[model samples]
Target: MSIQRELIETLQLNLIKHKVILLFGARQTGKTTLLKKLLTSDDDVLWLNGDESDVRLMLQNQTSAGLRAFIGAKKTVIIDEAQRIEDIGLTIKLIHDNYPEIKIIATGSSAFELKNKTNEPLTGRKLEFKLFQFSTKELVNHHGLLNENRLLQHRMIFGYYPDIVNNLGDETELLKNLADSYLFKDILMLDGIKKPEKLIKLLQALAFQVGSQVSYNEIGTLVGLDSKTIEKYVDLLEQSFVIFKLNSFSRNLRNELKFSRKIYFYDNGIRNAVINNFSPLAIRQDTGMLWENYLVSERMKRNHYDKNYCNSFFWRTKAQQEVDYLEEKNGKLFAYEFKWNSKKNAKITKTFTSNYPEAEINIITPENYLDFVL
Candidate 1:
């Protein structure tokens, strides 16, 4: 069964909306596949792969006339893995300026590579979109809610990476390959990452610490690196889309834990692969952390697809009062706590509730998690 991706129409609508479309995602999130689905035999397109040295050589240091001659009469040009080609932003800018009739699409696995290269050159000339791993809504649409609900534990363990979703019975090996291969390809290509083992060590430490407040100093000590290097490594990992940070929300309370962050992997499979743990949830001790990570990450996909404009955080106080997730939109605060066990009694902390009295709060469990994510 081919699962219909949600970003296809959005990308289709925006293709001609701007002179250039920049599609960014982590490796194997299906950017290339999604764009292929958007093309038809009726459209004229020229595809280029930046991974090829010849393609990189041909596109570099091109003038307007050179770009024009190279592109000829192509209506649409797609450069897959575009970040490999140096000066690609200038090349696209030249094409956009000279051939206003042509539409250019560029797909890059790493955002830092593409965004840093294009930000200045393609400022107003481009529309940007991020493609993520298979989302919960897409999965629900594919197999129906009843079946999807049954797969919740499986989803939490294996995650929703497109390839993982499509290729069953081979998920563990595939995730390990993805983690070992594409997960850090872009980061390791840089000059600063001389000791690749340290990067691996850092990720292993992070995998074990998922859903907890991350301390650079402690992580640095555990990984045998300084805090500054750890910060830089963490920044690179975030840019690579392997992980994300949710900052602590603070406002009126003096006890709020400010300047602290909790990091979650973009996909639970990647986190599990990092730690080399694919143990089922039944025998696992980290189910709560897994549930929290899955919920928060899926919520991110939901908001992105829904075009939700809201700020999200994990709120906590110095005295241990906390909320698992918090979102603010249109001057209204919504708070939630995640409980894996539906029978447990849960409530908002008096400290958090007293300060943000206007904030809405609820507890989410296996019985009602679908409402929170889907």
Candidate 2:
């Protein structure tokens, strides 16, 4: 079954405007699938894979005429894994500069490479989009609202990756392979890390500490690396879309704990795979952590897809009062706490409420989370 992605309309609009569209995501998140869906018989499309030496060599030609000859009147050119092609940014700049009528679509799994290559050359000439693993809203679109409750547990455990959601095969093995193979492939291939095991250990430690403040020195000690190296690995992991960091939110409160950050995985299944834990929720001791991670990630997808511009943080103080999620938009503050049980309710701490009296606070339980996220 083909699940239509929301980015198609945006990509089509960009194509009509003759802008280069760059689609980025983690490996196997359906970037190529999205591009294929946008292609049709009526369009004159030239498809090139950066992994191919011939394609790389053809695009490496520095002259505008050389690029024009390679394109040869093709109305559109699509490059897959474009970051692998040497001098791709310059090549793309030449093509775009000379052929104003040509449309270009490029897809890459690694942002560190692509962004560095294209940022300067394609400045103001490109539209960038991120395609995440399936979102709760997308699932609702596919199966309707009736099945959301039934699938919530599965989404929390197995995650919303396209292939995993579509397949009925062993999800554990699939997630294990994803964690073992594709999760760090870009990091290992692009960054010259001598000990991959250290990275794995760092990820495992992070998996166990989700929703909690992380200290670089502490993680470094646990993973047998220096703090600087630990920070670099974490940054690479975030760039690869495996995880994200949320910084502490402080507004000049002396008790506020600043300079600390919390880490969350982009998908729950990857987090579980790193920790080797996939037991049922009833038997799981970290269910609250799972729920917090799941909601935060889903909300992130929602914010991105809806183009909601906001700054996200987690609020904490020296007295140990905290809020699970904090979002500031248009100079207004919105805070939320996630509770796994529908009956349980979380209240805004008096200190937080008093300090930011203008901020709005809400508890997001299972019964009301759909409206909050979708």
Leading candidate by TM-score? 1
Q: Candidates' TM-scores?
A: 0.97, 0.96
Q: What's the C-alpha lDDT at position 5 in model 2?
A: 85
Best by lDDT: 1
Candidate 2 overall lDDT versus native: 0.88
Q: How would you encode candidate 1's per-residue C-alpha lDDT over 1-374 as one tens digit per residue?
A: 57789999898788767569999888899887787789874348888999899999999999999888887777889999898899999999999988888889999877878888999999999888888999999989998999999989988999989889888899999999998788656568854787899999999999888878889999999999999999988887887788989999988567889899999999999999988889999999999999999999999999998899999999988887889999999999999999998888889888888888999988999999889888
Q: What TM-score would you give candidate 1 relative to the actual structure? A: 0.97
Candidate 1 clashing pairs, residues 3+ apart or interchain: none
lDDT of each: 0.89, 0.88
Clashes (backbone N, CA, C under 3 Å), per candidate, total: 0, 0
Cα lDDT of model 2 by residue, 215-315, tens digit: 99999999999999999888888888999999999987899998889999999999999899989899999999899999999999999999999999999
